[model samples]
Target chain A: MITSILRPPPIIARMAFFAVLLGAWEWASRMGMVSRFIAPPPSEVVPAIGLLYHDNELVTRFLRTFGQVFAASGIGAALGMIIGWWLHHNKNAGRAFTDWFAAIAAAPLVLLFPLFLVLFGRNASTIIAMGAVAVLPPIILKTKEGLDHVPPVLINVGRTFNLTRWQHIRLIMMPASLPTIFTGLRLGLVFALINVVGVEYLIGFGGMGLMIAELGDRFEVAGMYAAILFVVLCSACFFWFTARLETWLLQTR
Target chain B: MAVANEMISRVTLYRVSAALFLLALWEAAGASGLFFKGVLPSTWFIGKSLIRLSGDPVFWGHFSVTLFEILAGFGIGSLVGVIVGLALGMNRYSGQIFEPVIEYLAATPKVVFLPILLILFGIGVGSKISLAALSCFFPMTLSLAAGVRGMNPMFLRVGQTLNLSLMQRVRMIYLPALVPPISTGLRLGFGIATVGALLSEIKLSNKGLGHAAMQAYARFDIPTMMAILIVIFALAGLGNMLIGSIIRLPGPNTRRLTKDRT
Candidate 1:
């Protein structure tokens, strides 16, 4: 048993490591090594998932948050790509605005959420707008980077075929830049989700953020973990889906 | 050279005009009552509010509180990050086992953990600091680990040939090799840390610029809120530039080497 544990397979090693960590957590919580109010055991957290399902609107809440994420990121990604494309084609404009975009991207745009709330009137629209704006800069910057980095050889190949600018862009330019664009999309989506959930938490209404806030307020630590677990799962799913989609799209090449 | 200089000048001219045009459009929108009165405050109103707010001592108090949180959290996070990253990167098996976990955590919206932090640390500066540290930790760790892993074997061999002690090797060879990734991590970590700190403040805090902005929002003082946001933006921009300059000063050689490697 000792040898097996020591020389464990990769999968086993990962599982064993987490198991040990969780076991320690359980032990600490049970033995009063940590406060019960803050660090509830996995035992309590697991059951709290069921409680959330039964008493709280777990599924509906997740769906609502998910909807906002999709709407905001979708708008952001589309706008980002269009603007990035336009900038790539317009050298003067691109040169003029690239540094501005970089500065905006670096800024903590989430601080503008209150202004969004004021404009959009404290609803899901406010959250969506905030998320979209939060995400837009990164996607735009990344898209431009991707397009700019596409190999000159690829463009030459299109030119050798006597391709027009439109054809060349649709075929060679886009495909070459798609990977970088996908990277931007993933980053933007993460930012969007963070902003959306943050707004929900701040506003103290609607979705998983609200659930986490409410549970925390009620001092239901277990329920809060369960809600957070669902959010982590949502994030993992987003990461995995985008990764899979990128691989599939790239496979055609 | 002349053509390039002319092109740069033209670009700058266009950029300035574009910004002025945007301000003009905003002013026109406010004047025309395109939206509600307060929803789209005139640029002049926002500029006036910003000046007035800058003179207010209470606003400075909040600003100082936020600056303290940012610097303290970033300092703690970067120290822990570099140490842990170096340790993990030096070990082969540990890096494999843990890098994926950190990557996953990095991808997740760390704000979700803010509740746990709040519970553990109370509703004050502790939670905000923890949030900033947590946000900064992942990128820094990943960057340093990647740096250490990618270190050339020749460097270590040279250190061995010189009969250098482990501490000497670390100071002279390993540390210099890490400058590029350290700067990258600092740039990325600082950005995320600032966001995390401000977000936590916005969520629940009696002090900080975020709290001040929220107060303005609560009072339906749109102009004040806008002014506060502009302040935050300016501060964030300044921070980014400061990091950029600091990183660029010591980073050119290593950055060029990394660029060549890629």
Candidate 2:
């Protein structure tokens, strides 16, 4: 077990690298080489963490944003999968739809936030809708690609065994498509998280984004940095978790 | 004359049908009064706003500034990404040392640094450009690195057997191998660049399409805001299609290299 842990790299080395960077940042700030207003030292940011923790408002706002992300991702993933599956049934239609859909996917859907706000008002629902809409195309595109790429030979084999359509899909297509579908889910989750934070930032709904905006407005650089750090940490955790999930899935298969 | 009339009639029918369907729905929603007046602006109001905004020089000025920032950031990011990616791919030690750092930074949403950037760059076009570059850099770097690394080892071996010059090998082998990945990265990078530029403008700027929309929002001018939003979306969609087509175009080097290999 110890060797397994050490096999990757020495944790000390990684920690040392982070420490050295932080040390340089602290030194630069103290030496007036870098503006503290622009990049407050970790010393300032660390203490401000306590202030944010004690602020119940901040915690509640974060929870609301989290709730929005979860709802949007859940709904978007379900709808995307269903649509993808439907498209998979018709090859030519799937291709044609994807041709147009890819353009939509590549467009920055955040531009639609105004329309969303107009339709849904300045509320949590709007945030959720924005996240869902932003992520749906990626999820749909990935899911369709996943389903379409399942080997034709496998389908032929299934048919040879006299399997029903549902059975063929469940037993073969799903398993074959799981990796690609997971990729879409990961992308969707990231987009959902981004849209939630972004909508909150722009519309002034309470969240980490709101906290950042509020701190910026107040010129509390340290507090803003702390909030930004929190967001970065959350995103980093999501990235790591999804990466591990992908690895595990690949291995299990 | 009859054939020409038939073609025109079909096209007109399609356009009118879509427009009528949209207008009818909007009119019905507006008449129902189930939602706030601001929530569902009348089609007539939005149409008028769109035409009015199209004639505004101030709007055009803001749009141009935003476009300049996006394009400049994309160019800078793509250059840096390609250079760094090439270096990392060519040097194993640097690749190992820096790959984790790059990945970590990439995973951390760059938007988190917006406040810091605003402070440093004074909420100007510089800040927007910086944000756009940061947003665009990751995908390009990742795709380029993958492209370089994914080159078939057999190609290298063949080049070695032929004792080809370093430059010749690069021109004949590496460049072709890198094209697909570089194209993909550029396409993704361009899209992210637009988003970054727009988001920065919305968050801090006094000008640009995003600012126009934000101003409309503040004043409860929903129709004007919608029009700006539509314009921004159309621009972003066009950029996406443009970059995507460039990437999808078959490179001359790719065909030549593949033929040589076969």
Candidate 3:
């Protein structure tokens, strides 16, 4: 209520703005104000999307990248949750390891891909390994946060009822921490996707990222733009899904 | 014993032991040669490579080039981000209107645009610096806008009551409120800026530590690669410390926030 606007503006305004933007881009490209090789504009980019669809290459690569992101993020988030929970329970010993994790997290994990490539080879496994590592810290941090949010009173109540450790987590701690853990999941997924695409581009392998790289190398600027657009759309979809999921969970509670 | 003394000893005892244990384990494993091929370079080898690289001026040149790119990119990107963010955040209508565009841009994995940047700026330092700026711009813009929008309403009302002019209001109220988020933005932006520069360097450029590392990898120079990785880790930590100093100056007005929340 405190942040409510003076009045809701017309949604058409945004559409109009975008239209103007596209028009400007089209003009710039036509007038040779911006190079076609660099930007390609919407006029060329529009046809580029059609070409991608016609080729049927987009779907396969997208699915492959999606699978990698899902698998890697799943592994990272699960490991992070268990380790984080264990660390919180173990107290000081856990603190020592966590400090190291924190430092690792702060570094750009994408830069550590060479070692991963050596270990896992120049395939999907290397990318997956890097993605999992990159996403681990946030999940661990959020898992600990989830545990911290569980009230002492609630834990004591569980103690009175003689709940096992797993039951304590599954019932009381889970409900308390689900929101935070979900936040970690969303964050982890973002990093996983990022690392997946980065590795794909670096290794010149399957995925939209590789397609973009290939298109650029071939001097097919419009197709490259289309591939980049696909990535952006996927990212937006991720944000939308996570937001909706968060709201749904909160509402049910 | 005093609480402070006990806290220090406890933390130091645990931390130092943990570090030593890990190092000894790594050394033993490397010595044993039981790891995946040559992936696990010995700690002794890494030390030798580090010393060898330090003596070479060419190695320092690569490090300096990357550092320069980061600094320049961060400086420009943050300046532009603040201006755009402040303009958009001046009112609710603007924020709503451009919200989708901003969201889409933020979601896009900025490094994917390396190819586009390469075409636009060529294979020189230009592309890397520009890419760093582009990547750095988003975090700063988001944080700055959030900072502006989240300013205490009470302060605005007080400004109106005092009939302060636009400049006066901005200086007295907005600037103070902006400090914390701007600092956060600066830190986050710098981190991404470094990532951006190093990434592009690795992707294509013929210079920088990223290039050095990649060159080593290409030749199967494990020890040199390990040495480069250590330097990168050290630099990342050092950058954070330096940026922490920058944020300390105009810190958040937590005292005011506490009063408001209560």
Which tens-of-lDDT digit does each residue in A15-44 have in candidate 1? 889999999999999999998887889999
User: In model 1, which regions exceed 4 Å deviation?
Assistant: A1-5, A149-168, B163-166, B250-262
Clashes found in each candidate (C-alpha, N, C closer than 3 A):
0, 0, 0
Candidate 2 local lDDT, B166-224, one digit each (tens): 78877777767677778788888888888888888888898888888889988999889
Error of model 1, residue A137, in angstroms: 2.5
| DockQ, Cα level, model 1 | 0.70
RMSD values for the candidates in order, in angstroms, are 2.5, 5.1, 3.2
TM-score of chain B of 2: 0.80
The runs of at least 3 residues in candidate 3 whose Cα sits more than 4 Å from the true structure, single-residue gaps closed, are A1-10, B1-8, B28-36, B161-168, B250-262
Query: With candidate 1 superimposed using the best TM-score fit, by how many Å does residue A147's alpha carbon deviate from the native?
Result: 3.4
Best by TM-score: 1
Displacement of the residue B11 alpha carbon in candidate 1, Å = 0.6
lDDT of 2 by residue, A1-253 (tens): 9965644454555666789999999999999998888788899998887898886366787787788888999999899888788667765456446655677787788768878887888888988998898768878888888988999999889989999878987999999998999998888888888888877887777577788888888999888888888888787787788789888998999
Estimate the lDDT of model 1: 0.85
lDDT by residue (B67-146, candidate 1, tens digit) is 99888888889889998899789887788888877877787878889999998888899999999999999999999999
- Cα lDDT for residue A169, candidate 1: 80
lDDT of 1 at A233: 78
Share of true Cα-Cα contacts across chains kept by each model: 0.71, 0.45, 0.51
> What are the DockQ scores of the candidates, in order?
0.70, 0.40, 0.56
